[model samples]
Structure formats: C-alpha cells, structure tokens
Target: MRRIEKNSLGAALMMALLCSCSGRTTSEPFVQSVSLTRPIALNRETSHLYSGIVKAAHEVSLGFKTAGQIARIHVSEGDYVQQGQLLAELDDADYQLAVDALQIQYDQLKDEVERTKQLFNQKSVSANDFEKASAGLRQLGVQLQANRNKLDYTKLYAPTNGYIQTVNFSPAEMVDAGTALFTLLDVSRLEVEVSIPANEYLRRDQFTGFTCRAAGLKNGVQLRLGSITPKADGNQLYHLTLAFAGQPDRRLTAGMNVEVGITVADTTRTGGFGVPPGAVFLDGEVPCVWVFGADSTIERRPVALREMDNEGRVVVIDGLTGGERIVRAGVSALEEGEKVRVVETPSQTNAGGLL
Candidate 1:
C-alpha cells in the first residue's frame, strides 16, 4: 500500500509542473503598436483662406429733392447710369409758372429801385426812401432765384455712377420730397467682406497682405484693408472690409462670392510649429502631446497652442522645437514611459506587409 501512494504522488507533481509552464507562457507583458509622425516646421509667414463675399463700396438711395408727380422715369432696374445723367422727371408746370411770376415781379422792382437811386443822386429823395426801395428790390431778386432752384429740383439726376437695383415708384406716381425713388448699387469701387474670429481680430495688425479668388479668376486679386468693426457680432465675429488694391476685374460685380486669403507675419522670436490635432490630448486641462523618444518609449510633453490654421493643423507656440517624432494614433490609450513598437506604413507594392 505504501508503494502505490508514492506513484500517485509522482503523477500529481507532473500535472502541477505542466500547469505552471502554461501560466508562464501566457504571462508576457503587452506592447502597444502605434504610428508616429514628425512635427512640421513653421515659417515666419503664414497664409490662411476664408470664405468672403463681394460687396459694393457704397449703396446709394436716389430720391427727388422736391415733392411732385413723376412725369416719367428714364431708367429701369438693372440699368447702368452715369453721374449727372437724368433718371426721372416730375411735372414742372406749377413750378415753372411760379418762377415766371417771381421773375415779372423782380423786373418791375428793379426798375423802381433804379429810378429811386437816380432821385437820391439828384437829392430829390430822402436817404431812408432810397434805402427802402433798394431793400425791396433785393428781396424780390432773392425770391426769383429760389423759385428757379425749385424748378430745377423737379428733375432727378444720377448723383453717381452705379447700377439701379430697384425702382420704387412708377410713372405719374406722386412722391414726397426726399423719398427714395431708385436704389443704386455704386460699382465705381468694389469691396470684399469677411467675418473673422476674435483671435484674428486681435492679430489684425500683424496682417501683411490680402488677396481674393473668385470664379473665372485664374489669378487672385490683390486687396487693401478698408475697415473693421469695433464691436463683435452675436457669433463673436468681427466684420472686416477690404477694397481692391487697384481696379478689379470688369466681370466682378457686387453680390458675387469669393475666397479671401490673408497673410500674417509671425512676431514671435521663436517661430511656431505645426502638428496634427489628434496627437495633442488634454492632460488635466493642459494640452499635451506624446513625444516618442529614441528608447522607443513615449513621454508626455505639455505645449502652448496659438490657433489652428486653415489646414486644420494646430500651431504650437511653445514646448516643441520641431522635427520631433510623436505618436499620432491611439494617443488616449497610451501611458507615460511605456515601451511601444512603431507601426510602419506598408509600401504601395507590398500592401498589408504581406511579404
């Protein structure tokens, strides 16, 4: 019975040794695979593109200076008019009759004033009598001139070169004085409008140049800064206006859509760097990136961000110098000081690393 018990114990020991070997084989540490990229070096000059719209430099509402019935309208909506060109006319029969009556009275008053002056020279009239006659003649002359001006005001003329956008009244319609008769879009000059964020608004002084691209424009049109609104809108965006540096294309008109490009000069002594946004993660409210070291390990590094560019790359103002390889994929699952294997991009001919 003692010999049988010894054999059973040996069998139990062999089974325990096999289980321990299996455990040892499956206890290896996990090494994560990740992709890496190098941060791009930024230059002192950076360019950004934004959607903008073309607008007329001035929108003018043309109206008559005197109240009258519109006799005729010479121009229609969408018609191009030039400065001093007659656009509309009012019924001027009443104004003309008033001017004729004033002229007749002025002529009679002039004759009386001349005779009184002659009498004063001959000492046949008192000084007060001569003065009264001269004053009456001057008052009548002023009245005649005012009536003539009113007659001229019966016609509406284009104050500037522009295209008529709207005709508010029809022929023979009675319009009050200073009532808008035509809406003119002044195209003598063109402007481009764009909305920018507060960050760009604060750095507006750093903008060095501006250009715009539109449909059918092979080359971009240069622009000059015109004005910026002091207050921000509900979207927290400031309205910026830019005028053409020179004369714009003849085909370009108001209400056309365009893309504006702005070039800004970097004022920082240490230039900024560009990195993919995914590589940057938040660490306790601080922006951080996983920088891969020569030892095949990652170190969490804090960085100062300025703003994202049009290409969606974050501009790093501090913490990274440039040309540093960083983990670009699966950054959230990474831990500090952990060893990782870099994932190599497969060549086009050897896709999936099948070879």
Candidate 2:
C-alpha cells in the first residue's frame, strides 16, 4: 500500500509540472500585428561648420582732404547721412579770408588785363606791356581757383549714403590730411567672410556637391560657391563669402562672428517605409528587425537602413513593405521566430507627421 501511494504522488507531481508548462505557452504573445510600408529611398544630407565674421559689403572711411581744426560735427555715430550731405565743418575762418583776398586780387588783375588788351589793339601800349599784364592776370586767376577749392574743402560732406559707424574726430580737434573723420557703412547687403582650412579648400569640389543638401536647411539661407582667393602657404585657406537669401533690415556691424555651414553631399531614395531607429538590430554586421509576419508568427528579417534624418528614424531602403507588421516598441528583446503580442495602440509619427 505504501509503494502504491508513493507512485501516485510522483504521477501527480509530473502532471502538475506539465500543466504549468502548458499555461505558460498559452499566455505567450503569438504575433503582434505591425503596420509596415514598402521600402522607400530618402535622401539625407550633411554639412561642415566653420566660423566667419559679418562685414558690410560697402564701407567708406571719411577723411579730410587737407589738414585743419574741426569746427563742428553735424552727425554723430549711428546717424544716417545721405550722399552729399554735410557731415562736419572744419575751421573755415582762415580759408574764407584767403579765398576773399584772392578774389579781390583776381578782379583787379582782370581789369588791368582788359585795359592792357584795349591799349595793345589800339597800338597805344607796347606789345611787351600787354603780354606782362596777360601773364599776371592768368597767374592770379589760377590762385583764385585754388583758394576756392581750399574753402570748399573746409566743409566735409558724406561721400555715400550710409550710417555713421564711428566719429574719428571731435569739434576743435586738429586732424591731418587723410585722417579719418567718420566711418560709414551701407548695410543694404551683408557678407559673411569665412576662412576655410587649406585641406578643406583643396576639396572645393565638395562645396559645390552639396547644393541639393541645403534644400531643407533652416533659416532660409542658401550658399553658393564664391571666388576662392589665391591659396597662400602650405596652410592655404580660402575666403568664402556667404550671401543671404534676402536683404536683412536689421542693423549689422563689421566684425560680427558667424558660423558658416556648407553642405557636402546627400544620398536619397524614395517611396519606402521607415522604422524607428530603436527597432533596428545588428546581426553580425547585417541590419535586421523583428517583424510580425502574417499568420501570427514573428521573424527577424534582414533590412537595409539609411540615416533618414536627425530625428532618430532610419529609412528602410529595402526589405519591408506596406501592410506588414513589425515590432517597434518591444523589438530589442525579441528574437528570430519569437511570438509577440502586439497591442493595438496609436502609432508614433514624426513630430511634423510627415516623414
């Protein structure tokens, strides 16, 4: 009777183990339905960043034509001046006196020359006498014109319409000829001067290769390959100018540093589906993903991926089609042929909802 009881107990234990195993198998996720799409190609572009400075395309340094003491400044720094507008005046008292004196002397000489010419024509004066008068009158005329020019130089006018960047001289300050009085700049167009490293400059072809790469870049800024200044030294660097897409109304000063990015190249494919970057797995250098196949079965399929964007989505260039389900959320722990239960939930989309 004891032996029979022991046998019955052993049988019960084995049955219990079998029941537990059956229950576990029933609860396992068979296959999770995943929405899939046909593989499409998406072009991705990248860029190289460099630093530069913003400078006015048009700039003028105002200076006096002659040396003199400043009498007045009509415009201050940051003031807008028009072409031919008086910006300042030098002390003109002495200049005016010189001009006035020369004018009087010129008038008197002119009268004498006219009188001498009349006498010579009538034969009343010697030819030598008329010639002497003519010489003196001509000399005086030249002196008078010089004095007028000197007087005009005393008042400074803007050479071009622009904003005053700096005031180099103040009222009563003595300045020599060619000494800067004001710095003016036209902000209608701005240029960014970027210095490219020598090695990168030699690869100038790369700059032009990326024109399509900038299509979707931010700030509506576009770049074009400008003149590359002569290469100098073993460390040759070229200066690249960045032109803005539109004129900026905001004020820009000289020497403002900026970051310049140039696209190099891009690879694109179209009409395919993409998967979350997290869903991609590496199987011995092969790109694979756990996909919920039809008939409630999970299988890991090899796929080709390209970095679609910076937003953590990989373009499935190949190996996937629309209407197929793939494990997106719980893909990391999933194995090949592993059964999965896909909870039907809202699918996550790119932030803009457009791939």
Candidate 3:
C-alpha cells in the first residue's frame, strides 16, 4: 500500500508539470517576421513616352502657271530631285509661235524708232512723231517679254531638294493652270508630331528634353521643341511639333511611326517618397502602407499617391516622409499595430540569409 501511494503521487506531479509547459507555450505572443526598407527619395524629373509620327517639314505641290498639254514628264513618282531640276514639260509649240510673232513686231518697231529719232535730230520730223515711234517700240518689247515668260512657264522645275510623291499628269494630258501636277516632299528637314493630353499641354513650359526612337535607329535621336498648338483640337488634345537637334539619320522618312520620350520637371511633386508597389495596400478606398514604428510594431498609414516611376515603384506624395521604415514584402497578412520582427537583409558574401 505504501509503494502504491508513492507511485501515484509521482505520476500526479509529472502530469502537472506537463500541463504547465503546454499552457506557457499557448500563452506566448505571436510575432511575424517581415522585410523592411526605407523610402527612397523621389526624383523631381519625370519621363513619359508617347507615340509619334515622322513628317516632312515642307510639302509642296508643283503646278504650271500657264495651261497647256503635257509634252513629257522627266521624272516619275518616288524619284529624288535637286533644286532647279526640270520635272516635266508642256507642249511649247503654241507658246513658241506667240513669242516669235511678238519678236518680229518688236524688231520692226525698233528700226522704225531709230529712224524717227535720227530724223527728229535732223529737224526733219516733229517731236511728237518721234515720241510716238519710241512708245510703239516700247509696247512691242513688253509684249515680247510677256510671251517669253509664258514659254518658260510651260516647263515645271523643282523648287527644292525633295522626293516626288505624286505625278498626276502623263504625256499628252491637258491640265489647267494652278492645278497640282506633282506632289513634292521636301526631305531637307524632318519633324516629329505628337498629340498630348490637356494636362500635359497646360505644363508645356515645364518640358526639359525630348528624344525619339524609330525603326533601325538603335541609338535613337535627340529632338527640340519646334512648336505647340495654342488651342486644343476637337478631341481636346494638343498637337506638339518637335524638330531634330541635328541632321537626322537618312533612314528616317516621312510618315514613319516613332516613339517619343518627353521629360518634364515635376515641381508639384516635391517632398515625395518612392516605395515598393507591394508595400502599398488599400485601407477601404484609401491607399495605405504598413509603416514599421520604433517599437517593432506596424501601423496602417494612408498615403497620397502621385505617379509610378519607370522602375515600377509607387510614388507617395504625402503622408509618409523620407527615411521611414516600411514593410517591403508580405504586407497583406499583416494586421494593424501588430508586433513584428524585421528580417535582416543578407550580405553579398552570404546570400539567401543562410549565414
């Protein structure tokens, strides 16, 4: 009976100790491990890329000043031409005949004027008769010049160095005066055209720099502000024209599509902080982030967002200042004012935090 009592008491003490240990384990506070990072200083310069198109600075329409039948076309569409090169010619038979007729009359009147001038000097003719002869000679000379100009107008010449975009008339085709016979695309300079929204148009003066990228141009090209429309179009978008800083590559041509990047100074975004996108969460409708405090506890803080950067980081314009430690990863499972343990970043020599 004594031995049985002693064994039963020992077993009861063991059970009490086991129950105490389990209770202590259950009552311990839970602390979540999380990665933390300090907010980065936001850059005051912001860059945005937009779609643009290459266009020739000057597009000209070639036409004849006088109406006539097309005698021949010296060049075809897509041909490159230099300044003063003859592009086409009209049938000059009728124009030549008119000039010839005027020249004959002009010559005859000139000889008559000289004879009258000598006779007047010799006191054989009246001053009025000499003046009349001289006047007739001058009138005939003016007529001759007018016909010569018409003969010259029958031929069309390139006004500038350009590429022929269109040839509307062919040989033996009759065309009216001032009708566009050819479309010339002046390739001496190029311009890039892009449409921007109203917000950007309002801050057009804040633009700092511009660049463009096109097919076959790996290094890209720099551009300068050429002009911007003062008023918005029907779509409420403003048109911006950009010119090349230097001579552009020869491969770039009119109507080709390109990508334009514009950089602007963000004066309104002063005192902003850049944080990882994963660190930002939503508190109801408002954007919130988990800010780890000095006491090793995280609280949900609302932040006013500006815009995302090129590296996919969220820019917080208000609420959180720089040098604040925020949870960088695994923020969804966290609760308000929850105690947390910061996991140290691994060293370069000891990756994966194994060491």
Candidate 4:
C-alpha cells in the first residue's frame, strides 16, 4: 500500500511540471495599436486667423438741417451722389413767400432812404429823420438775407460724394430737424475691422506684417495698420482697424465678412511643443500627455502646458521633446507602456487641425 501511494505522488508531480513548462513557453506580450502624431515644434511659424468684416473707411449718416414736410426725394437708397447734389426737398412755399415779402420791404426802405438823403442834402430834412431812414434800410437788408438762407435750408444736399446706403423717410413724411435722413458711405476706400481677444492685442509693431483676404476674392490684400481701440468692447475684445495695402476693389463694400490671417513668431520662448487641446487630458488634476514610443507602445507622459493660442491649441512647455509621437485622442482610458497601433485617416488629421 505504501508503494502505491508513492507512485501516485510521483505521477501528480510530473503532471504539474508539464503544465508549468507549457505555460512558460506559450505566454507572450500582447500589442495594442492607437492613432498617433508627432509633436510639432513650437518655434515653427504659427498662424492665427480671425473672422472680420469689411467696413467703409468713411461713413456718415446724413440728417435734415431743418424740420419740414418732405415734398420730394430725388435719390433712392444705393444711389450714387456727387458733392452738393440735391438729395431731398422739403416744402419751400413758406420760405419762398417770406423771401418775396422781404424783397418788397427792402425795396421800399431803400427808396425812403434815398428820398431822405436827397432832402438832407437840400437842407429840407432833419438829421434824425435821415438817420432813421438809413437804419431802416440796413435792418430790411439783413432780414432779406436771413429769409434767403431759410429757403436754401429747405433742400437737403449731399455734403460729399458717396453712395446712399439708406433713406429713412418717404416723400410727404414730416421729419424733424437733425433727424437722420440717409446713411451715406464713402466707398472710395475700404477698411477691415476685426475684434481680437483682449489678451491677444498685438502691439502696433507686431502688425507691420499682416494679411487679409475677403471672401470671393482670389488674392490677399495687404493691410495698412489703422487704429487699435484703447478700450475693450462689450465682449471684452479690442477693435483693430486695417486698410488694404493697395487700392481696395470698389466692389468690396462695408458689412462684408472676411478672414484675416496673422502670422507671428515668438523667439523669446523656447523648448515647447504644440498639441491639440483635446489631446491633453487631466490625470488626477495634473496635465498629462500620452506619448507613443517607437516600440509600438504608449506611455503616459506628464506635460507642462505653457500658453494657449487663440486657436485653442495648448503649448507644451515641458516634459516633451520635439519629434516624439503622441496619442492624439482616446487618452483617457490608456495604460502605461500599452502597445498601440498608429492608424492614418483623412479626418483624423482634420480633427486635430481645429486646435
């Protein structure tokens, strides 16, 4: 019986040894694949594009100088007008009649003054009577001149050559003095207005080289830096005025939208890499980036994010050297030293371009 028990124990030990050998020989590390991109050197020329609108260099809202009932409107919205062109007419009957009455009164006074001066020369009139006649003529002359001005005010004329953007009132409508009657735009020159974030206000020196391209145009227009608002707007942005480097096309008018591209360089900064904002994920409140190694494996690398551009991309200031391949997405649920495969897709790159 003791001999049988010994044999069974030996058989059990041999089976256990065989199982261990098979396990050791068949086990191999599994490989996992993921999408990856190379870290772009932050020193490379970077571009920031902003959407802007084309504006007239000079715009004016024309207002009526005097209040009256509109009798006629000679120009329509979008009409081109020259300097001193009559744009509208108010009722001038009252003013014209006043001028005629003033003319009659001035003529009578002049006759009386002439008669009084002759009598004074003949020593047949008193000095006071002659003086009274002379003063009456002078007062009538001034009154007549004032009436003439009132008649002229009945007509609204263009102060400058421009295109009428809009006419606010119709014929027969009563308008008040100093009320806007038309909106005129001087399209002789054009400008682009772009609002940039308050934080990214470019110094006047930085704008020496900037380009703007309007929609439906083939080439870019050189920008002559205009003015930067000293104050922030309601949206916490600053307004930048830029004019075309050369003569702007007449077709490009106010209110048209355009894209302004500004290329900037920062030599003061160094040792940085550019990556998509989404590519970075927080690992326990610390910013981290998953770097892919040449061995088809990924390792979690902590990154020091420096500054973020207006384009939503974060600048990695530390923990990453340029040219290291990194996982662009799906970094939230990844392990250290995880094997990953790099896949190329058309949209995969476009997705990253948003940054």
Single out the weakest 10-residue window by summed lDDT for candidate 3: 266-275
What ranking of all candidate models by TM-score puts the best one first?
3, 1, 2, 4
Better of 2 and 3 by lDDT: 3
lDDT, candidate 1, 1-355, per-residue tens: 9999999999999999999998998897889999998888877777888899999999998898999999999999999999999999999999999999999998988898899999999999999999999999889888899989989999999989999999999998999999999999999989999998898888898999999999999999999999999899999999999999999999889999999999888654245788888999999999999999999999999999977765678889899878789988789999999999999767899988889
Put down candidate 2 lDDT per residue, 1-355, tens digits, no spaces.
9999999999999999999999999997555445433333344445678777767777888888878999999998889888899998889899899989988998988898898899899999999999989999889889888888888888889877778999977899999988989889966566677887876776666564311112233443454554567656455667776666555325444566556777644334344566777677888899887767665567888987765654356778678765666666556666677555555554486554455
What is the alpha-carbon RMSD of candidate 4 to the true structure?
8.9
| Model 2 error, position 146 (Å) | 1.4
- Measured against the true structure, the TM-scores of the candidates, in listed sequence, are 0.69, 0.61, 0.74, 0.60
Sorting all predicted structures by lDDT, with the top scorer first, yields: 3, 1, 4, 2
The lDDT values for all models are 0.91, 0.72, 0.92, 0.82
All-Cα superposition RMSD per candidate: 8.6, 7.7, 7.0, 8.9
Best by TM-score: 3
Flag regions of model 3 displaced more than 4 Å.
1-29, 275-325, 328-355
Candidate 3 TM-score versus the reference: 0.74
**lDDT accuracy of residue 307 in candidate 1:** 78
Q: Predict model 4's lDDT versus the native.
A: 0.82
Off by over 4 Å in 2: 1-7, 19-52, 124-132, 197-199, 209-238, 243-246, 250-261, 264-355
